[model samples]
Target: MRFTSCCGGAGAKTLVLVGKAGNGKSATGNTIIGRRVFESKRSLAGVTSTCQLETATLSNGQIINVIDTPGLFDSSVEPRLLATEIAQCIKMAKDGIHGVLLVLSIGNRFSEEEASAFASLCQIFGHEIADYMIVVFAHGDLLEDNQCLEDFWGPNCPQLLTDIMAMCGKRAVVFDNMTKDEDKISRQRKELLSLVEAVVKNNGGKSYVNYLFEALNMSEMDLIDQTSEVTCSEKSHEGKKFHIKYEEQFEQLIKMVELRLGECIMRLEKQLAEERVARLEVELKAQAAQTKSKEEMIEMKERLERAEELSKKLEEKFKNAENQSKEKASETIWSRMGCIIM
Candidate 1:
């Protein structure tokens, strides 16, 4: 990550781009920088498989820092790997982000998986991410009859997009990613900058601030204090006029966070329960094997005892027969002695 602009602070703005694979996230980043800094090509998968930072001086005089990230919520990417990459992304936005461009393609299906990916930023980085977020629709040329984006806004549009618009204060912009016209580019860029300004003003001219990475450096008590501040700050800030319509949306985002957390806990508990059942099944089998061995040993001991008893009876009978033979021999010897005396 590098910042090449001459000035910093108020003159600068940081934006992060997030979306599913092949959703034109990289193209949006390129368009933002006024150059093809990121590779935009036809593909079924994401070209930027990791975080890439690029900076440029926009016509609006804002030094824009764009962090283009991979499809973090794509099914192909491992969750553990995605977590590491997302942390890297937050590190790049160390100064806090002024805008989060949730990119999506126009005239395409927004599946539930993609919707969750759209919502995951709030779920992972805390609901504060939504305060500075806006949806940018790529491939704007796909609209039929040269229709405007607003015309595609009502109930007739995809429900996911509608829900997403409601989440980000209905702050969205359209772009033809393939368009090379400088005038159109400048116009769209200004619209995007205006949206960014709204987010910044909503936060009292401050960027989106979160302690996810900062918490790693703080002590337990310090982290607790930080969390307390964040919780209190969330309650204290009702937001500026820019966010007035979306106040309830922010509240809903918090509730969504709680629901997501609850869902995670339930999944973990169910997993643990399944593991316990599997372990108990294994233990029961071992116990049964041990019991069978003990029973076999007892049966062998009883069979040995019966064999010994029969041997003892045979020995007693043999001894009695020997004694009777000896007595008969003695009587014969006495009869022979009497005959000799006569």
Candidate 2:
């Protein structure tokens, strides 16, 4: 995340400057970059109509990439166009942005149009940007005697501006971009980079990523995803350990359910077995009753045959007696007739 290429092999810092038009935005860029790369002329139409980016090594031997946006916060340009321009600026900082310098003119009145840029920046980048942000009071040469950065911006400053700076961790700096004093400019740029380095250090050497920046460019999202995966991996490892700790308890629960189910099945089988035994006893009783009935039927049949034979014998005796009586009656009739003839 450091650039050692510029300024004869010094480490780098990527900076993006944002503010209203004619607020010395380009001049501030030239100061940090240590060159006249950006167009810094005053005009009714304003200088730098579109976004321009340049990189240079500062007098501190630190390479800084500056993206100067034109009318990004000014009311002259359309909001849609400004949005496009801002996106282009972010695209140039794909290496990762360490600082978002909110450039405000030292003495000018902050207009409603410029005041609205704070909200727009949030929409474009994300809320996290304001965390490590630094407020640059551009045109710092206008400061009167006994009037410092905070006293001027704090006492009568617009409540909106105060709140915007508060979002930047209450950090601010002054830049005399017009000053030709080589020593003063050098000191200012050095302090500015030092403040930026503190922010990076507090953030653990990582740049602030706007969640919305992901949709603006794929690389930001990939960076977030990679970081998230690493974070998730650490948490997942902890989760795996927790799972292992409870594995024995989980097995015990399963075994308890299985044992209970086995007991239920055994009870059902015993009930079925009892029913089968009762059924068999009933069948055996029925077979015994049937056998007794058959035996009684055979005995009754034999008794009936005996009764018929007894009745035939009785009938023969009665017929023999009747025949003897009839013979006697015939003899008496013959004797009576013979006596009458004599």
Candidate 3:
């Protein structure tokens, strides 16, 4: 079913940048705002530890509100702390989220953590949130000369990254944050904003809002009871047909969203388990190799010790034989001299 926009109209639009740590979410946010509003730097962990909101007016007089969020799937961050950070992001975007820029770096290999990123987002913000997502690949400067973004999506590209782009309706833009070319930067910014605008337009000029999140948070039982109440009220008001149909559709949509979200969560859990197993296997192989090297060294040392003992024994035997020969020669010489004197 097509999703109708629930909030935010034309004028200022709000976009949220989300991804794993060190993926350049903060850098992307800064690029979108046309200034260094968010603190961005090279780090193993995310530089932006909290959600920060900044606004800027473009040359065309279009105002954009960009929200830079802490790393969503950072391993170093505690789950509770991550949840708190997400809550802060939600609070900052309470008015509505026009677009969710899933910032990623083109230079880095798409990892398992990145593969599970969307599923995790689905778990937190509901499956429908994918409708508002746009994939923004940072570090476009890493792209070879004369190579376009499409070049990276060849057969060698990670399937997970392709899947994410497909889920986001193939809406993506490459940003060369390190580029100093004014025209190039402007073109990239325009392309990104164009995609965002297209999403907003497709959603009937409305943004994804907290209301949808609240509705998704409701239990199936709660939804059923709510529908029943609405049905009864509609019947009393003599508008049963319209209200009943709408409520039924809405209820079904919620249930579908919940089911999809559950599946996403399960898939994410499976991916994580597989990653852990793979990591363990690598560690075990390294340990086994180390143990084999140590055993080989010990065996070589034992061989050297045995060879040394044999060498010492052979040397002593040679010395004893030489001394015996010398004594025999001396006795012969003495006998010869006595004979000469007689």
TM-scores, all models, native as reference:
0.61, 0.57, 0.63
Please list the C-alpha lDDT of all candidates, in the order they appear: 0.74, 0.70, 0.77
Higher-ranked by TM-score: 1 or 2: 1
| Candidate 2 residue 220 C-alpha distance from true site, Å | 11
Evaluated against the true structure, the overall lDDT of model 1 is 0.74
Where model 1 places Cα greater than 4 Å from the true spot, the runs are 1-9, 144-146, 216-342
RMSD of 1: 19.0
lDDT by residue (tens digit), candidate 1, 32-77: 8988899888787778878999999865466999999988767566
In terms of lDDT, model 3 sits at 0.77
Error at 175, model 3, angstroms: 0.2
Candidate closer to the true structure by TM-score (higher is better), 1 or 3: 3
- Candidate of highest TM-score: 3
- Clashing residue pairs, backbone N/CA/C < 3 A, model 2: 3-12, 4-10
lDDT of 2 by residue, 1-342 (tens): 122111112357778888877788888889888878999965435688777878886545667788888776554555456555655665676556788888888767876556556765654455677766898988787887657877666678888787887788878889988789989888888888888888777666766554323333454444445445555558677556545544543344334333433444455557668979999999999999998999888888878878888777777777777777777777788788788978
Model 3, 116-160: lDDT tens per residue? 777778666767788899988898888899888787767788788
Rank order (by TM-score, best first): 3, 1, 2
